[model samples]
Target chain A: MNMTTRVSRLRGDRVTLAHGGGGRAMRDLIEEVFTDVFRPPGREDQARLTSEALQEAGAQLAFTTDGYVVTPVEFPGGDIGKLAVCGTVNDLAVGGARPLWLSASFIIEEGCEIALLRRIAATMAAEAEAAGVRIVTGDTKVVEKGGCDTLFVTTSGVGAIPPGRDIAAVNIRPGDVAIVNGVLGDHGATILAARGDLALSTPIESDCAALGHLMEDVIAAAPGMRAARDLTRGGLASALNEMAAEAGVTVELSDEALPIRPEVRGMCEILGLDPLYLANEGRAVLFVPEAQAEAALAAMRARPEGEGAAVVGRAVTAGRIPVVTKTAFGGTRIVDMLVGEQLPRIC
Target chain B: MNMTTRVSRLRGDRVTLAHGGGGRAMRDLIEEVFTDVFRPPGREDQARLTSEALQEAGAQLAFTTDGYVVTPVEFPGGDIGKLAVCGTVNDLAVGGARPLWLSASFIIEEGCEIALLRRIAATMAAEAEAAGVRIVTGDTKVVEKGGCDTLFVTTSGVGAIPPGRDIAAVNIRPGDVAIVNGVLGDHGATILAARGDLALSTPIESDCAALGHLMEDVIAAAPGMRAARDLTRGGLASALNEMAAEAGVTVELSDEALPIRPEVRGMCEILGLDPLYLANEGRAVLFVPEAQAEAALAAMRARPEGEGAAVVGRAVTAGRIPVVTKTAFGGTRIVDMLVGEQLPRIC
Candidate 1:
C-alpha cells in the first residue's frame, strides 16, 4: 500500500502525551497521521522528496507570523494545528504571495498527552506540505497548566509574492465591486457545534483552503482589482468597514448575493448572532473595478475552492458607513461593523 | 503637553465593554494609549502622521506577528502591552529588520473594566510609538467571561531588512563567536517575584526594549554576522542549543562571561530552577565571524540596549549539547533546552 492511503485509516485512535515526547510513538504519529493527511497530490514517490523542498515554490518570498490562542485548542472540523497552517498561509495568499515556509512555536501545557502533541505537530507538517509550505523550524515549551490553555501554536510563514501585482487595503477605491469567494459562517458555526452547547448538528465544515491560486487567477484576469481580504476574524461586515474606512469609500453588499449556508443562518438566528459579523476560516472578499466584476467572478468560480464565489457588494461614491440589503421585504439597513464579539475565538 | 503625553494620561474611571468592543472605546484606546506610547523621540510634532510613507525607513521589509498569552497580562517591570510590542519587534530585530508598521488585535473577556483595557492599550500604543512604528490596523473582540483569560493582544509588525543580508541558523559555523546583549534572568526572576511564590524578592525589571537600532549597529560593523536569536522561550539554554543543533556544531560557554543578577541566582539556587532555562524577554545572542567579533561587540556595547553586551561563547566542532560551567566549584554541566515549561504565559 502507498504511505498516505495506509496512514489515513489510523485516524480513529485518541492521542496520548507520549506522541509528543520525541519517541517512537511520535515518529509513528508523524508517519501515519500527518504524512497521510498532508501527502501532496501527484507525489507517489515520497522517499525522494525532502519535506523542506516540498513547500518552496516561485522566486520572491513573503513571510508572515501569527499566534493562535483559541479558548479550546481542539475544535470541531479543526484544531490548533489546522488553524495555524491555514491562518498563516491565508495571510500570504491574500497578500498575493505563494506560501513557501513556516516556523511553528508550540507552547504546550504541562501533562499534555504525547499522542495529542504528536497529532498536532504531524497535522501541522502535513497541512504545510499539502498547502505547499514547509515546516522549517520549530520550538516547543511546556508551560504549567493555566499558564496557557492545553496548546497554543504560533506560526511564522514565509512565501513568495507573485511579481507584477500589488494588493493592499489602501488600493481599494470608489466604484469598485466587492465579491465573496464562498459561503460565510461555516467555520464559526462548526466551532459552536463542537462546543456541544446548543444541541445543534449540521453537516458543516470549514472552507479553509490556501487562496493563492484563486487570487492569482483573479488578479491575472483583472489586474486592476484593488484589494483582497480574507474574512476570518471580523467577517464580511468588519472587513467591509475596514476597507471603506481605509479607502475612504462606501461599500454596499446585496442581501441576496451573500452566500450563507442554511445551517449557519439558523444557528445565528437561534443564538441572536449576525452572520455578517461571524467569522469564516475559508473565504475571501475581493474588491475589483466595475468593468472586471464578471471576469473576477468567473475566475473565482473556475477553482474548486471558489465554487460559491459571487458578487456580494460594490463600492459607491456616497455614504461613509458600510450598508447592506435590499431585503425581500424591500427594506434597507446598515450593516455596521461589529461593536462586540459575536462568536469569540472561532478562528 | 504633546499629543502622545496627553493621550497617555487620559485615564478613565472604569473600563467598559466598548473598550474592547472595536468601536468608540477601541478608537479612544488607540488615540490615547498607542499614539502616545509609540511617538518617535524627536518627531512628536508629526504625531498625526498616519501615512505609511512617513513610516518606512529602510529598503527591505521583514514582518513578524506574535500574540501575548502570558498569564496575568500585567506583570512586574512590564505588562502585556509592552511585551506584545517588544517581543514581536525583537523577533523582527533579530531577523535584522527595522520595524515600521504594526497591526494589533485585542481579544478581551466580557466584564473586563474598560479602564484596565484602556491602560493596556495605552501602554501598547506608547511602546509602539516609542519603537517608531505606526498602529495602522487593529481588531478587538470580546469573549464570554471565561472564554479567554482577561485580555490578549496580538501584534503583527512589519520592518525593513537591509540589503545583502540573510542571516539564518545555517550561517553559524565552528569557531563563530557568540555574544549576549545583556544580563539574563531578569524577566523570569521578576515574574517569579510577582507571583508571590517563595517570597522571592528582587528589583529586576524585564529587559524589554526595541533592539532594531542595536542590530543596525551590529550589522553595520560586521555585515557578515552569522546568525542572531533572541533568548526568549526556554531562555539562553534553549536558544543556544537550537542554534548549535541547527548549525550541526557544539557550543561552549564560559560561566564567568555569563551575566546573572545576584538575586536571580540566589532565587534559582533556592527554587532549584536552572536560571539558564528561565525566560529572558529582552536579551539576544549574536553569532559573529571570528574576524569581526571585536567590531560587533564594540558596536553592540555602544548602544543603550546593549550596555552589558559580552562574548560569552564560541561554536565548537563536536558534541551535540551546549556546555556551561559554575566557576565557583569548577564544575561543568550540559546546558540543554528546557524539557518542559519553566513559567507559563510569559511573553
Candidate 2:
C-alpha cells in the first residue's frame, strides 16, 4: 500500500468536480476509497447501500449525529476519520444503546488528495469493526477548490436499547460517584501541537478511540449506573456540570484524583489552559451508585480504552453550584462551563 | 417580523466565534434560531436532547444520509435547508419507508449571516412538518472565514416500514410500467439561472418538494409496485438506466409522453442540455405492474408534489441497450448516463 494506504489508479491526486458529479467518475471514487474499505461481505453497493438499506429489521433505535472539523486533518495519533466514527459510536453507547449501524457523509474540497480520503475511510472502517458497528450507508460531495479547507465528515449512528434500559442526564442520584474512563486533555493538547501554533515539542498522542466495548463492561457491572457521557468538544467539565444541573445537585471533584498525564498537564500549564475543559476523544464519564462504584471502576480499568480509569467526584443532594472542585490546597472552586476556546476547528 | 420572519434580538448580523462556543452566546443562537422554531413543547436544555432521544418504541427503521451544497444557498423556490431535509426524506421514502425522524448537522463559515441561517432553519422546520417528520436532533459547528462556503447541511433520516413490506431496485419486472411524478429539468434550469452562469431570462422554478406523503399514497394504492427512484443529481436518465441494468431488462421511454415545462425546455434548448439528464429535487420514477399502473398514477396525481405526474416509459423483456427512447420525430435514440454533469453544484 502507498503511504495514504490505497492504490491510486483513478484520475488526479486531488479531487475534481467529476468526483461528485453522480456519474462514472463519482461511482469509481466511491468504490475505490469508500466501498473497498468500508463494505462488508455480500454487499452490492457498499459505499451507499442505497437499495439494500431499504430492508428493515424490527428494533427500537437510538439515533445521534456529530460533525468533525478538526484542522490539520492529521493529528499526532488520530485523524478526522477515526474521530468521526468513534465519536458517533460512543455517543450512542453512552446513551444506553448497542450501536448497530452508522451513516458516514463526507464533504470534500475540490483539491483534497484521494489517497488521504482512502486512508481516512480505512481508519473509520477499522474503528467501526472494533466497535462492532457497521457503516451501512454513506454520501459524498465535493465542492469548488476554495469553497472549503479540506474535508469535513459527519457520522450519524443508530442503535437499539434493551426493553428495560433507560439512560439520561437527569438520572443522577445524590450519592452517585463520578468516574472517568481515561486520561483527559491528550486530544486537545495533541491538536494544539499539531497546529504548530505554539511551536512546542512533545510526543503526546491523542486518546482517540471507540468506547463501546468498555461501556458494555461498565454497564453490565454497575447495574445502578445513573448516567454516562463521552467528553468531546467541551470535555469533562461541561459534561459534569450539565449532569449535575439536570439532576438538581452539586458535583464535587477531587482535583488530585483527575486522570491527567504529566505531559498533558505540563502542556496545559505552559499554555495557561485548564485540563478540565480540554477535549479527550477516547474518554467517558459514568455516574454509578455508591454501592456499585468500585465494581464500575474495576470494570472500566479492565479495558484498554479505560486503563486510566479513576473515581473523580461525588454528587451532593442540594447545592447552588452545579459543579465544584476541592483543590490540593484544601480550597474549593467552581468549574463553570467553558466560555470559549481560542482554538477553533478542533473538532 | 421583518422580511426574515422571526424576531431577532441576538448579537451581530453575521455569526461570530462566540456563536459556536459552548457558552451563553452559543446557547442564545441555538435557542433563537434553532430550538424556538424546531422544538415541540416543554423541554429543558433546548440545545441537545442527547438522552431523551434514546427512548424508542420497537419498530423497524430505514436510515440514510445526504449532504446538500448547492450554489446560491437560496434558489427561486427552495433553499439549502429545504433541500437537506427533503432530499434525505425522499431517499428514505423511495426506499419504501414512512419517514419519521431526522438529524440536521450544519458546518457554517465564520461570517455567514445569522438571519439567513434562521430563515433557512425555519424553512427546514416547515418542510419537515409538511413531510410528517420531526427534526429530533441537530448540531452546529463553525469554521474560520475561508474554511468553508457560507454553509453546508447534512441531514440523516430514519424511517419505519410495517412487516411484509420490501422494496429494491432489482425488483423491476420486464413488463413494468414507468411513471414520473413531476416536470423534468425545472430544478436544473432554475439552479442554472440562480447561479447566473448562463444569464438566461427563464422564469423556471425548482421542483423542490418532499415526496414522502406522495410515496405513502402510491405504495398504499399500487399493490404490485416493483421499484422506485428519486431523480436528484443525475435525473431520470440515470435512474431508469440503473433500474434496467439492475433488473437485466431494457427501459423504453416515449419522448412525447415525458412531462416538461415550456420555460425549462426553452432554457435547456438554448444551453444545448438534455432534459433527461437534468436534476430534479421533487421527482420520483416508479415501476408498477401494468394492471396497477393506473392506480399508481391516480394516487400520485392526487398530491401536490405529483401534480405533473405522467406515465412516460416501460420495461422490455430483452434488448442490448439498458435505456432507449422513441423520439417525437419517429426515431429511436439511446439514453445513456452523462459522462459528466455541466451543472456541478446544482444540488
Candidate 3:
C-alpha cells in the first residue's frame, strides 16, 4: 500500500468523538491505521505477548517512560511519532539494556485529522522497525477539541540488560571521559523552526533517531563504560549536571571539541537559547574510562548515528562546581540545570 | 505529612507553564506531590526499580498500557488517579499475572490546580499501595492553557505470571463457564453523574478496585481457567463477544445470573443504555471449566473486590451468533459491541 497517500484518503477528514469510543468505529479505525502498521502480516490481536517468551529469553528488564507533547505534531526531519519511538528507545539504551518491547498510549483531540493519525502511526512503525524494537501494545483515547492539542504520545519501554553489564550515573569516576554521539541541539532547533516562532528559514532537522543499535556496539567495545544518558528536555547541560551530582564529582567540558550544527548554533544565537541546554533526541552522553576514551570514540565514530561523536569533556576531582564549560575564548562558565524550562513541550 | 490536607497546602495553587519545563520548579512540584506520595521515604528519583529484583523473583513479565481521560477527573468512588492505577493493574491481573510495577505519564494543562494534581497523586499512591504495586517510573508534560483539559494520565504496568499458567482468549473452549468478578456499569455511571450530565444523585461509586490479589486466588483455585479479560471501556458484553470470536465458539449468557446492582440497572434504564455494555473498572470476566466454576466463584467471593462474583454465562460449540444474552423476559438478544461509545473518556 502507498502509505503516504493512504492516510490522506482515509474516510474521515477529522476525528470525531465516536472514533474514541471503544466500539465498532474505534476498532475499525485502529485496525486500519495502527494494527495494519505495527503488526506483522496475518496476526490478530498482536498486542498480547505471552509471558512464556520473556521466561525463555531470561530477560532482565530495564523499564523507562517518556511523555511527548511537542507542538506542531509534524516537524522537520521528524514527527511526534518518530520522537516518541526514539526518545523511549534511547532511554532504555542509555540504561545499559538491549531495547525490546514498547507500550504506547495516545491522547488525541477529537478534531485531529484521521490522515494525520495514520501518518504518525506509519512513521512510528517505520522507526520501530528500524530500531529493531516492537510496539507490542498501545491504548488510544480521544478527547474534545478544547481538551487537548492535536496529539500527545506517551511511550513506556522494556529492555533486557546483557548479563554482567552494570550502567548507572553513579559509576562515573573523576577521571572518566564524557562523549556525545552526534551533533546536539538539532531537535530543539527543529522544533523551534516547526513552531514558526522564529520565522527563520533554517534547515536544522531533528536528530531524533534511535541510538540503541549504536549503544549496543559502544557497550560491547567499552566494557567498562561508566554510564550513558540521552540529551533530552533540558539537554546536554542538564545531563552533565545529573551525572556529576550522582557521582559527586566535577565535570568539565572543552567547548572547542563540542559537536554542534552551525544552523542550530545560529538559531540559538538569534533566539537567546543555549545549545548546551537544547534537547537532542539522537545524541547520547556516554561516560567511559579515561584510558578507553580514544577506543570508545573510535567505536562511536564507526556507527552512522555516532559519526560525529566527540570527547567533549572529562570528570575532574570532586569540587564545588559540578559542571563547567571552557569556552573557545579561554574562559569557563558554570553549567547547571535550568531553573525553568527554556522551551516547553519540545518533547 | 497528612496526605489528606497536604494537597491543598502545597505552595502553588495552580500548575504553570514552568511546572512541566524539566527545571527546578518541575522538580519541586514532583517532589512535593508525585515523589512524596509514590516513592519510599528519603529516596532521590524514586521511580526506578532494579531488574535484579525481577530476576530474583523469576518474573515472567506481562506488560500492558491504558490511558485515562475520564471527564470530571474526580468521580464518586474514585478519581482519575485511582482509575489509572487500577485500570492498568487490572489489565495485567486479568491476563493471569501478578501485577508489579507501573510507569505513569501525566499530561497536565497549564493553570491546572496544583492542589488537584496532588490529590490525584495521593489517590494514585493509595491505589497502587492497596494493589501491592510500585509506581516505579513516570514522565510529566504540561501544555498551554486551552491545550488540554485539566488532566490526563497514561499508565503502563508490568506483572509476573506464575509458572505453567497459560491464559488467552483462544484457549476458551465449549462448555466453559464465564464468571464476572463483581457488579458492572458503576464506573460508566459514576463518571456520568460526576460530569453532572446526568441529574442523578444516587451514591453509585465506581467499582474501580485493583483485582490482582483476588485474581491470584481465583487462578490458584481454578488452574483450568482458560482465559480472562477486564471489562473496561466496553464492559461485559464486548468482552464476551471478543472471547467468542477469538475462540470460534458461541457464548450465551444467562440473564438471571448476571450480578448487576439495582442502582446501576436503574441508571442504565433511565439513560436508555444497557448495563451489559457499560464499562467496569474493577471487574474481570474469567473463562473456566464449567466443573470448576463453583470453586472459582468461591475463590473470588472470598475477597471484597470479587464479592459479587457469579457465573454469568457459558461458551457453547460454534454457532451462528458470537454472543447471545437471554433476557429476563424469556427472550434471547444478540449483544454486540456498541456501534459508538456510550460515553467518551469514561476511563
Per-candidate DockQ vs. reference: 0.11, 0.41, 0.52
For A1-347, candidate 1 gives per-residue lDDT tens digits of 64553433223354444333322343354456444444432111101112222222323344455556565667666777888888777877877776765555565555566568666777777677678776544434444544445666666665555545567767777788899999997877887787777788878877667676788788889888888778876578877777787777788778888899988898889889888877777788989899999999899999987889989878887574555656767788888777644655565
- Total backbone collisions for each predicted model: 28, 0, 2
Residue B218's lDDT in candidate 1: 95
Candidate 1: docking tier: incorrect
Candidate 2 C-alpha lDDT tens digits along A221-286: 998888888887777887887777778889999999998999989988988988888888898889
Write the residue-wise lDDT of candidate 3 on B1-347 in tens digits.
54565543334588888888766677778778787678742122223344433443344567888888888899789899999999898888888877888988898999999889888999999899899998888878888998888898999998766656678888999999999988888888888888875678888899989988998899889989998888887788877777788899999999899888898898888889999889889998999998899999999999999888888899999888899989899899888877777888898
Candidate 2 chain B — worst ten consecutive residues by lDDT sum?
B45-54
Off by over 4 Å in 2: A1-9, A40-60, B1-9, B40-60
RMSD per model, one decimal: 7.4, 4.2, 3.4
Question: How would you class the docking of model 2?
Answer: acceptable
A-chain TM-score of every model: 0.81, 0.92, 0.93
Q: Write the number of the candidate with greater lDDT, choosing between 1 and 2.
A: 2
User: How many Å off is the CA of A254 in candidate 3?
Assistant: 1.8
How do the candidates rank by DockQ, highest first? Answer: 3, 2, 1
DockQ of 3: 0.52
Cα lDDT tens digits, model 2, B87-181, are 98898888777787888888889999998998999999999999998887777888889988999999898776555566667888888999999
